[model samples]
Target: MANEIAGLVVIVTGASAGIGRATAVSLAKLGANVVVTGRRAERLTALVDDLADFPGRRLVVPGDIQDEQLAQELVNRAVAEFGRLDVLVNNAGLGHHSALAEMPLADVRTILDTNVIGLLAVTQTAVAHMKAQGSGQIINVSSIVGQRPFPHNGIYSASKTAVNFITRTLRMELRPYNITVSLVYPGLTATEFGQAKLGQSGGNRFGLQGIPAQRVGDAIVKAVRYGRTEVYVTLFDWLFTHINRLFPQSIDWILTRRS
Candidate 1:
């Protein structure tokens, strides 16, 4: 299965940092030609530099995922460069830490625009290419918060829950085209996600404790190779999700106590 990953062309959004950055490097190291996109030009350049010694090739396209044009261009560039599109890892997202009622409209817009709209745009573009090619993989990096909403993260949770629904719908819609749509729900990852929204001090209270971003990256690769439909990076997280589903009131009680 490891050889299945080699020489495949991939695109990873939010490649400048966090899970996106880690997944891009991990895929490249596994011998997959990678196209990385993000808002930070220098950081994307630095990521390419970091992967210089890897077996596969790399392309850096720096831009925000919120632009529909950027999403189309990313797919066009991947096909133009690699001759075929094999995988897309949709990892770009933002978090807003506040009650839904108290959250700023600007922050709400930012979260929905980038996390939900941007992801759907990118997926539509990629699915078009995958339909033409007859086979492809899409791994969307969601979060545990989406499955079980917590206090103060209501907006971010909505965005990811939306992603979860989109992933499920695409899985059924694209199956005929041999396109595999996978959702990756990560727990609290040690990344700049919270800081981007809440600044340093407030960011710490956004969710559960942190784990390394590489764990999510690693899960993504495994899902791609094995054709997994859903992945939770930690067993504990997976268990938590199922437990919440089986006993919603119990989980709600637990969260109520935590808050």
Candidate 2:
């Protein structure tokens, strides 16, 4: 408990790679006992190998967070490993992309299952314990698409958009209990997640995007250090998100041209 985040026990899903993995490492460096969950046991082991000297405690729980039973089990595993839970990073998500016309209902359902439903289940489960403790933080990972509707990725966009709305609402609901809810919208970053998860990607359709995954990881670190309601990792992205809000028509036209 000597590091910045020393005393907190944080759970990060989708921890096999990308933002989730980066977050686990970052939090660990800060002395937070971190529990990483993902489906791939090998990748989780590799992650532990990479962060061999983390300042804080590290545990890996390989499982699908999309299941309700698994979500509760995730919290149980964290408490069992770390003694208590102080933060829950809901980063386990899947992306689905395709033109609405070409999109299969099954693919869209999968996106909702992983992104929205799973997130809700985990958050709900965390709330019970956080409410009892009277303090905690829940960081929900969303995307730029949560704010801007992307072409050929209607389903993915909607799923993250739901995260945006839900996180905000939970923030208000949990405020009295001293529970902090935050939404992190990472525009674009160097993560194999996009290509590996979503069949059709926005990178090709929407040209060059945001910065590295560490930038988002840095933002997560900031959120953990000083609780925030919402955070946009990149300055330009933060600017554009605001701009899109005020000038929806122009942004829509720009997106149409780009797509």
Candidate 3:
């Protein structure tokens, strides 16, 4: 029998904190050799040290995934150090807020580049390794915004929408080689990811209570092991998004300050 994700070689980007950190730690606990990558070397080092007894090896490759070349190098390093790449968790991302009119082109580009293109760059290389292996799993960390546009979150929603689309495409495209793609769209989670600022403070204390990051990490572990197309970490989040589609502008009347 195959390893069933246990003792698998997994690569996780943006593993410094939030969902990425939790996911890396969880995968490690599941007997996976997880390669954690991010721009913050210190944070990565701390996580690496913490998971010292995580059943499998852990390595930290610090860098910005926005750089396509560096993205390739990340895969090379993981393959070189771990000897195989069974799963790639494209979790490195940032979320920002600003009215579309006031949104800086630079800011817009940053969101698109990091969330969209940056993810694609790493995923491209991951697929290459998986294809060679003849079987693998790619779990793209998306958002509830991907399925439905929410107030004060246009560009972020669009980028996630792109991720959602690409994930479905990858599933169909890679199926020939037995590669599976799982899109994990999480709702309110108590991570820096839910913050108003990128990896900063502020979260969804009002709309819907957030969940612990460990819950999502555990879910990813299950998805990787069982093979799922797309999953929402919370039922409420999934319901909220489905409602938003039928009533897009309905929430505008809520006039929530934080939006």
Best by lDDT: 1
The per-residue C-alpha lDDT of model 2 at residue 223 equals: 85
Candidate 1, residue 162: CA error in Å?
0.4
List candidate 3 stretches off by more than 4 Å.
1-3, 194-208, 246-259
Error of 2 at 175 (Å): 0.9
Rank by lDDT, highest first.
1, 2, 3
lDDT of 1 by residue, 1-259 (tens): 4428989999999999999999988898999999999999999999899899999888888788888899988989889988998999999998877776776788888889999999999989988889988999999989998998887788888999999999999999998999989999999889888678641136344355789999999999899889898898999999989999999999888777766
Expressed as tens digits, the lDDT of each residue in 1-259 for candidate 3 is: 2346677999998899888999998888878899999989999999999989768898888998778787888999999997789899998888876566667788788888899999999989988888998988899999987887654567888999999999999899999999989999988777866553542243343666679988888778778877876888888877877877787767544535446
List per-prediction Cα lDDT, in the order shown.
0.88, 0.84, 0.83
Ranking by TM-score: 1, 2, 3
**Ten residues in a row with the worst lDDT in model 1?**
198-207
Q: Which regions of candidate 1 are displaced past 4 Å?
A: 1-3, 198-208
Clash-forming residue pairs, model 1: none
Local accuracy of candidate 2 as per-residue lDDT tens digits, 146-249: 99887777888889989999999998899999998999989878887777776664545656754777788889878877887688888877999999999999
TM-score of 1: 0.95
In candidate 2, stretches whose alpha carbon ends up further than 4 angstroms from where it belongs are: 1-3, 201-203
